[model samples]
Structure formats: structure tokens, C-alpha cells
Target: MSGASVLYDAPGPKTKARNRLYSIVGAVAVVALIAFVIERLGAKGQFKPEMWNIFNYADVRNNLRDGVLTTLEVFAVAAVLSLALGVLLAVARLSDHKPVRWLATGFVELFRAIPLLITIYVLWVILLANRDALGLSGNGPQFWALVVGLTAYNGSVQAEVLRAGIVAVPRGQAEAAYALGMRKTQVMTTVLIPQAVRAMLPTIISQLVVTLKDTSLGYIITFEELLYTARQMSTNIIVNGSDTYVPVIIVTGVIYVAMCLALSGLATWIERRGRRTKTGVAPATAAPAGDPATAADTGKDPAATP
Candidate 1:
């Protein structure tokens, strides 16, 4: 009883034992259910292997590679534009001018409130109508419409993320910048924005992932993106007179997941590099003004002396 009391206070022992038992039971049940489902599905031919065989075809491979490239192109363009728009909108919303602030506020709210699918569809229709003036040809209209719609929606989300990041920073920092006679735009661009960017990098990266996934929505506008290529391939390649939809879908999904995972890996590397430095930029402290002694003296004590 004394040994048990020292290791796991009173009721803790029973609770711990119960939790372990429950975990083991849960794991076993999940494995059993999964095994049963897989066996049943396999027996019924629902898990056919040939559906995934389309990847071996040169045509399918070429089309999917093209689709992958197009998807990356659209995502890159939209992500950059969205980040730029978000920064501008965030600054505008924080503006002293009533009109500028109001306009920015309305724009962010309106787009954020609307579903991205509807926004893309509407833009597609609008672009199709004025295609000649916009120099639209080939996949240009669909691309631009997808880009613009994604920009608006993701921009709104990123504006809020930026605003939140800015607000999270110590108020003293902004006040200090202002006290130094920096103009509003200078303070925001040179100081606040950079710091906010570092602090909110994860959120920013997550929004980029959203933008990447949103590129699939381009299919609705007839854009020949990844999903469109998959659908086309499935339609053209019927295995034994049956649609090869499942195989193409699996391949396309794997492509998207791979791209996203790569982006995530890059973000992780950046984050690690940032942690090795200060503010994801230059070292916070510059080289000493002169001698090491003078530099140390000039720098305020990190801990308050009693």
C-alpha cells in the first residue's frame, strides 16, 4: 500500500490501470473491424487492383503530370496574390481614414462570408462574358477567374490572420516605433508586418494549404487542373466497360497529398531555421558598438538586478 501510494497517489493507480485496459480493448476492436471490412470489400471486388493500374499507361502519366504542373502554377500564383492582398487589406482596415477602412472592412467580410465555390463560379461566368476584352483564350479565363476568386477568399482569411498576429505582438513595440517618428505606413510595413509574419508563419502556411486545395475547385469552371485530368482519364479509360473513376481519383489524390506534404516539409525547415535565429530575420542584437565590454555594458541587463 505504501509503495503504491508513493508511485501513484491514491486513486491514480486504479485510473491508470483502467485507462490502459480501455486503450488495449479499443485498439483491438478497431483492428478487428478494419480487417473485417477489408476482407469483405476485397471478396466483393470492391478493392480491385486494376483500377490503380492506369498509372502505368503513358498517356495517363503524361496527362496527370501536366495536370500536376497546372495545379502548382495556379496555386503558386494564387498564394502570392492572396498574401499580397491580405497584407494590403489588413493595412487598409487599420487605416485612420474612414473610407479606406470601411472599404477594406466590407471587402474582407463580404468575400469571407461567401462560399469560395460560388465566388469562383460567378467569376468564371463573368470572365466568360467579357473574355475578349480580357484577352482570354485557351485556359486563360478559367485560370484568371480561379486565381481572382481564390485571392479574394483566401486574402480575407489571411487579413484576419495578419491582424490577429499584429494584435498579438506587444503593444509596447508598436508604440516605441511610433515614438521614433516613423510614419504609419512605415511602422506597419517596416516593423509590424515583418514581426507579424514571423509570429504567424504557421497560420500563413495553413492558409496556403487551403489555397492549394482550392485549386481543385477550378474544375467547375472547366479548368484543366488535376481533378479535371483525372475525370477525363477515367472517362476515356474504362476497364472492362466500367468507369475507371476510382483509380484516377486515387492517383490524383496521391499527387495532391504529395505536393501538400512537400510544402509542409519546406515550412517545417523554414520554421526550424527561424528558431535558430531571432524574429526569422537578422539577429536581434547587432555587433557590439565597440569593445565587448562596452557592448555588454550598453546592453541592459536581461534580468533586473535586485
Candidate 2:
């Protein structure tokens, strides 16, 4: 048996048999539940050819394509802005200055505590109300509202993640840097932040995935994103005397899953690349004050060196 089994006694034959039995029962129950759901959906004609055929329409396909593009645009802007804001907030929170740390803490806490949906909706309303004064037009209000709300909420979460990663670094590394006469800013930027980023990359990317998914909230403000477009298509399209809501929803949900998986894959690739790269500080060496080599380099004899 593996040493890890010391956490608990190894299972006896009877225990193993019971575990297998439980697993089989759970699997059977899950299969039965899925079968029941499929039967009901089929009865409702959701699996019919006509229901699934709506996606073949050029207009529907164009709407989905445009929706995906818009979603990607909002996600890209929000992800970049949020990461920048997160780094700033994290640095501020780590500052030796008390007021700056407190202000950063307050900002992070406030946004983290608020509901993201409400934040987005409120921003949308405010932007729409002041559209002319803000020089906003077209989908500008919806886009900005979604982007800013995502930035605020995800930025706070990422700040916490980065702070935790920084704190997790060994104190010895910072001490060594200081011993080399490095300033706090230099140590943080050159040593701490790089290590922290590598350690917290997975968490940062996960928050970004949440930001992408949250773009669906734009539907509430009529931003014409994937979810909003799906709703629009479902409502307007009739298939075999019924609405094509299920098929449209299924396709939209699949698209979301695909995008999130792609983000995860990208994060994994970056993590692998980081692991392959060299990290940490290189030690500095100094010659003894009276060494012959040092004295010769300085054009002075060692015996005559002060």
C-alpha cells in the first residue's frame, strides 16, 4: 500500500466491495435521471429536426457570429483593464504607507461586496441617462457598462489573489534583495511581483473566465451579446409551431463552454512556458577590499591600500 494510506487504515475486502456497490448505484441513479430528462424533452419535441434547423438560417448564424465578436471585444477590454487595476490595487495594499493601504483595502472590499449584476445594470442606466453629455453613441453605453462593472469586480478578486501570492513568497528572498542594497520598489518589481504572478496565474485566469461568462449579463441591458442574441433568435423564430428556445440555448451554452475551455488551455500553456523559464535573483559578488586583483584593477598595490 502507498504511504499516503497512513491517513486512514487501508480498506478491507468488504469495504472495497461496498465502495464499488455504492459507485454502481450512484452511476445508475445519474443515468436514470438523465434518461428521464431526455424523455421529457423529447416529448416536448425539443429533439425534433425542425427545432434544430433554425441554426441553419443565415440571419441566425450572422446574429450568433456578431454576438460572439461583441462578447470577445468586451471580454478583451475588461480582462486587460481588470488585470492592470488588480496589480495597482495589490501594490497599493502592500504599501508601507498606511493611508494608501487602507484606501486600497476599502476599494477592494466595497466592490467585492457588491453584486456584479446590479453593478452592471446601474452603470448601464447611468450611461444611458447621460449618453449625450458623455459623447456616447451606438452600443457604447452597454459596452462600457459591462466592461467597467467586470473590471471593478474581477479587479478586486484578482487583487486578493495577487496579495496572497506575494505574501506566500519566502521572506528570505526579500531580505536577500535588501542585503544587496535594493530598494523596496525594486525588490517588489524585480523579485516579488514576478514570482507572485507565476504562483497566482491560475487564479488570475480563472477570474478572467468568470469575467467572460459574466458578459452574458449584458443581455439584461440589451447589449446584443451571445446570450442576448440567442434570446432574440429564440423569440422571433418559430419551428414546427413552437419556439426554438431550447436549441438556441443549447448552442449558446456550448459556445460559452468552448470559450472558457480555450481560456483555460491558454492559461495552461502560459504556465508551462513560465515553468520552463529561469526565475529568482542572481547573487552579486564583491572582491575583498585588500585583494591583489582588486588593488591592481584600481592601480594600487595591496600593501599600499588604505
Candidate 3:
């Protein structure tokens, strides 16, 4: 029987047949649903070669290339800043001093509680209003606003992830470090943080994916990111007597999926590497290979008996 059947009584032949029938029905339903969607899209000319031909235009290609570059730029900056801020916040929240802990907790709670869209919009407006004073120009307000908003929200979340990883460390490890006369800072920086990073690397990379997607929010502030470029192409570039909205959306979405999958693949590779490194060889046995009774009777170290 399958392991799932262990939770309850194994299905009898009749029940197994019924389950197979249900599975077949479900599969047919899914196939029919997909067929219907494809039929509708085909009728709407979404599958027409002309709709996809806009991608062949030089201007469209340039715009998309620039959009992808800008999106990656924002993601790179936000990712680095968020990670740094997260580390600082996590350390502060874990501080022994009550004031520092409370301050860090409040900051994380505040940012994490607010809607990310609202935060980005507010920052955009505020920065735009003071653009001249801040020496801001051409996309500066939009760029900084999006970057800072993402940093605040994601940093707060990353702080919690890191803190959880740190807390999950074996208590004995911390005690052992303390016994070695390491100060709290030394213990955390040298011991807890490194192990926590290894344990939490996957979660960290997942959050970075979230950060990448959230860069789309920059569209609202006119940041000229990927989605914004897609919108422009769909609206302005007419082909085959119709706007290329569907094709543009499909292409941009595939790009986003490709980037996210790349990140996930990197995370998986790193996790495997970490596991291999952590798997140490078994210690060489000092005990001799002999009958335990004989070794004990002769008062010889069982490990040393040949």
C-alpha cells in the first residue's frame, strides 16, 4: 500500500476503481478547460503572427531592453540595502538592551504592517515634492522612492526570517560560545549569524524574488520598469488591426518567470553545496575490531582490540 494509505484503512478494489474514475474525470475537465481558453484566445486573434510581430520592431526591442535593465538596477540596489538593513534590525531586535530591542521591533512592525503600495506612493510623492532641494532629476524621485519603499518592507520581513533562524539554533551552541568567554557580539557575529544564514538562505532568496516582483510597483510612479514598458508597447504599437496587449503581457510575464526561476535554481544549488560541506566524515574508530565479550573480559579497550 502507498504511504498515504497508512493514515487510514487501505482502499478496497471498488474504492480504488472509483478513485481512478474521479481522477479521469478531473483530468478530462482540466483538458476541456484549457481547450476552451485556447479556442477563445484563438478567436480573439491573440495567436496571430501579426500580434507577435511588434517584438520585431527596433524601438520596441530597445524599450524592453532598457526596461529590463532598469528593473534589475532597482532590484540590485533594493536587495543589497534590504539585506543590510535586515541584518541591522535583526541584531538590534536580538539586543540585550531593552531600548534597542524595542526600537528595532517597532520599526519592523511599522513597515511590515503598512501596505507596500501605499508606502511606495507616499515616498514617491514626498520625494517629488522636494526634488529640487535634494538635487533630484530625471527618474531620481521615482527610483529612490521605489528602492527605499521596497527596502523598508522587505528588510522588515527579512529581519524576522533571520531572527527566526537565529532563535532556531541549538541553545547549547550559544552556551558553548559563552563558556569560551566570547562576548555577546562576538558570539552572534562569529557563531549565530553564520549558521543562521546557512539555515535561512532559501528563505532569503525567496524574499529576494518577492523584491524583484515588487519592482513592478514602480510602474505606478512611472519608473519605466518592465511592466511599464509592456504597457507602453501594448497601448502604442498597434499591429494586425489590434493592440498587442496579449503578446506583450505574455512576453513580459515569461521574462519575470525566467528571472524568478533562475533565483530559485541558484538557491537550490547553494543549499546542496551547504549540505555537502556540513556532512563531515565519520571519526576514525579507536576501538579494536573484536568480540565485545572478549575485549571486556580482558580489560582491553574494546576500540583497540584487533
Candidate 4:
């Protein structure tokens, strides 16, 4: 075939140069867009010191702290419960029993299908409906409503993450575990989960970030989270020369971004540490079997069954 017409030919130098030009143009466009946004917000007084100075007020400070605490409270509770529920749901989905699998499948699909805000609002209304009979008084109903809604929504998401993680683990691992006389449960808990968790740690953490953000939905029910406090402060404060609402909203968003970034960094650290371990265990493992060279360099024979 002629060089110009050959299907197997790599891109010509001219084509490669053109592609590079396109990439450069795209990058510049993105950078310009970001710069323009920053400039616009600055022009609107969002970045002004006077606007943020409201946060220095004692009332503002206390309200923000309380909001942060309330946010953390719901996040911690929902995270633990969601993780537990997710594990159970994941295991059930993988169960040999058809009924258990179907039930888990339905539960995961049902909650995940609904909007998170709707779920929280529905639970809040339900609690309000039977407050006396359920003995849920005062903030009890609201707190639990938020907690359960977050759990149901986030738990479904976590279940899908875990299921995908489990599937990503080499099938050979589960088979090997079975060959070693491990029951399904033992293989799953002891073998699959540890490794799958490491493999899917990022996704799990991402779902947790979603859960953290979803806590803002609690504001609709008057649960008083960080966003709620920000909105309240924005409404109550009238800075002499600034857009208080825009500034406060930006600050609140930045706080959420910072927290999520920290969590993501933690996940990245854990993942790297997991990679350095021997048996996919903790960082302090005595060996490094995962590294083929670690054994060879140390003059250890892996074939020796000691």
C-alpha cells in the first residue's frame, strides 16, 4: 500500500503537530475560563476582606462551629452505619440464596433510585407523623431522620462500590480461598474484603464525600448544618461594602472542598501504604510478598512451605 493510504501507518508528523496545537489551544482556553471566573467574583466583592470579616463575629463564629460540629456528627454516624449496611447488602447481593440476593438487590436499587433530598425529606415527614408513638421527641426525630436517610442513600452507593470492588478482585483469589477450606463467609470477610477495600478505597471515600455533602440536605429539615449556618449568616449580616451572600456561600463551599480534599488525601495515603505491604495487610507487615524482588533480593525462597 502507498504510505499515504496505508491503514497501519502511524500519524504523520503534520498530523501530530496539528494535534499538539489543538491540545495547547484547549489548555489555554480552560485556563482563561478559570481566570475570568476569578476576576468576575473579585469584581463582585466576593473576595473582599470586609465580607469575610463577618465570620470574626462571636455569634458568627459560634454558629459556624456549631454547624461544623453538627455536620461532623451526622457524617460520622451516617458513615459508620452506611458502611455496615453496605457490607451486609453487598454480601447479601453475593449470597447463594436467591431470596437474600433479590432482597439486597431491590433495597440497593430502590434507595439509590430516589433523590437524596427527597429521601431525607420523606423520612423527616414520617418521623413527624408518628413522633409520639415512636417516642421520638424534639430533635430526636430530626436527627434520626437525617441519619437514616443519609444511610439509605449512601449505603446503597457504598454497596455498589463494594460489589464492584469484590468483582474486580481476581476470581482466582476467591477460588484459591475456597480450595483452602475457607467458607464463603470466611473467604469474603477474610480474603476478599481486605483486598477489595484497598482496591476500592478511593470510590468508597468518594461516596463518603457524597455523604458529607448530602448532609447539607439536612438544612431543609432545619437540622442546622454548615450550609444552613452559612445561609443564616448571609441573611443576618449586612456588610457595609460587600455582597455577604456570595462571599459566605463561597466560603462555605471552600470549607466543604477542603474537607473532601483532606479525606481524599487520606485515602491516597492509605492506598500507597497498602501497596507497600506484604500480604495486602497493614503498612507494618513483616514481609513484602507483593514485591517479587523483595524476596529475591533478600535471598528468600517463596517456594519453601515452612
Per-residue error (Å), model 2, residue 21: 5.9
The sequence of per-residue lDDT tens digits that candidate 3 reaches over residues 4-43 is 8688667799989998999999999999999999899999
Q: For all candidates, what are the clash counts? A: 0, 0, 5, 0
lDDT of 2 at 187: 96
Q: Residue 20, candidate 3: how far off, in angstroms?
A: 4.9
lDDT of all predictions, in order shown? 0.84, 0.88, 0.89, 0.84
Candidate 1 lDDT tens digits, 206-241: 889889999999988889999998898789887756
Rank ordering of all candidates by lDDT, starting from the highest: 3, 2, 1, 4
Report the number of the highest-TM-score candidate: 3
User: Candidate 1: where is the Cα deviation over 4 Å?
Assistant: 1-24, 44-49, 279-306
lDDT of 1: 0.84
Task: Tell me the tens digit of each residue's lDDT in model 4 across 1-306.
Answer: 566667545769998898799899999999999999989988877777787777778988788788888899999999999999999999899999999999999999999999888988889999999999999887888799999999998999899999999989877788878987999889999989997888888789878888888888888998778988888878878876443898778778888888888887887887777655534332223265664334443445343332
For model 2, the run of ten residues with the poorest summed lDDT = 278-287
TM-score of each: 0.82, 0.82, 0.85, 0.75
Residues 69-158, candidate 2, lDDT per residue (tens digit)? 999999999999999999999999999999999999999999999999999999999999999999999999999999999999999999
Span of 10 residues, lowest total lDDT, candidate 1: 279-288
Top of the candidates by lDDT = 3
List candidate 4 segments past 4 Å from native: 1-50, 241-243, 278-306
